[model samples]
Target: MSNLFVKDIVVSYSGLPIIDRLNISIPDHKITTIIGPNGCGKSTLLKTIARILKTDRGAVFLDGKAIQQLSTKKVAKRMAILPQSSEVPPGLTIFELVSYGRFPHQRGLGTLKLEDLKQIDWAIQVTGLSELKDRPVVALSGGQRQRVWIAMALAQDTDILILDEPTTYLDLAHQLDILLLLEKLNKEEERTIIMVLHDLNLASRFSHNMIAMKEGSIVAEGPPSKVMTSSTIQKVFDIDANLTICPFSTNPILHSYQLSGCTQDLLENANEG
Candidate 1:
């Protein structure tokens, strides 16, 4: 299987550093989630790993080699990335949209070979989009549209898949649906899944490993039990998280949160006299 990691990577914009010399290794065939409050460089770290944005001072390695040295097509063959949003053409069909993923494997003239077609079909089937394969992209609901995007990634037939905030703009049920699909893919197919999420409860429930960031640095990195504690939550997000274990999921659940900043606490402490 292919391995992916970043070493001492610094990402900056206009001399302002957003991520400073951060190193992270993604375990093979596991779900790794990056979590942090706003502007903590979670997305920057992910973009660096996907090679979409260049790192100022360090390198991203894939299979023991620097990823930048590899051809774009070579990297695409091993990893697929879904950005926060995609612009769909007005009249694009689901099948047509998904077929674009096969471009990396296409030879001259870009004909869909039998293998590519079969892979596309399998992707649709696995994502539960078989019935909607011929539907127009503009007509599907939010959840279905998200599935279509993930289906497109699956068509790449890669060992690693990266998504940025896949649950955005989705309802609680739809969020669960998307995460469950990813869990299934990781467990059954052993695809390395890396994603960014804002929901601590969901991240705790779903991720095999969690990396929490603050001001371009990692506050915690380990299993959910290690990072979901009240102290870690306070350090990473500046909030005191009330944590409890769910009987069904057995993962840490976020019961609630209270602001940690002294300025935000205006209520007077009243002790029973």
Candidate 2:
């Protein structure tokens, strides 16, 4: 499968730029997490990469072609995105919702072909929602609902999955529930997983690669040990942090953090830069 990457891309919102000529290549079959402070363009980058938002300049290339040049159905077959917030119509059954993912693969009046049923069944089974597939999505817990959405994406049968803040609004345990599922998808299915995450610790623990952004620019990008340094944390979020290796995973962990003394000054300097 071809990898997704952006080159010198500029993205704007409401006449203001959020990402300025940024570039990055997503490694195939790996879990990459984008981390940054609020308003730092993490979600903007993900949306642009997923083709949910347009870029003002340069290109987002997926499957070795400029994404904008491809049709929606063509793109959907190669990559799937789970946005930060999705509104599900009330009373929709989990099976019904996941069935929507088959739309990209549908043809000739959108009939549910045998292949479509197989994929849907696989998605529901892997997400551990087999028994609840007939239940209404509105009746499920937050974690279960998240799994339902993931099942929808999985049903898409794409090589790449881009998620914006996948763990937002989820409690601590549910957060792991989602991330662990993503990890499993990467390791077992060899799917490329990219996401925006606010929780630094979880991101560090789960991500094979991490990108740290500050004010619309990347401050650092690498494996957890390289990107989760005290300097990068302070520069990106204006928070002084203590870092150590996670003995179990051998990834860097944020031991503790507090506001940096030069928070205001760093912000001012970065804005000026």
lDDT of 2: 0.90
lDDT of 2 by residue, 1-273 (tens): 346888899999999999998989888899999999999999999999999889999899987889999998999998888987788899999999999999999987888989999999999999999999999999998888888999999999998998888888899988988998999999988999999999998999999899999888899999998998898888898888878888768888887776989656766997999
Write down the TM-score of every candidate: 0.94, 0.93
- How well does candidate 2 score on lDDT at residue 31? 92
Q: Which ten residues in a row have the lowest lDDT in candidate 1?
A: 264-273
> Candidate 1 residues 168-190, lDDT tens each?
99999999999999999999999
Poorly placed runs, candidate 2 (over 4 Å): 262-273
**Candidate 1 residue runs with Cα over 4 Å from true position:** 261-273
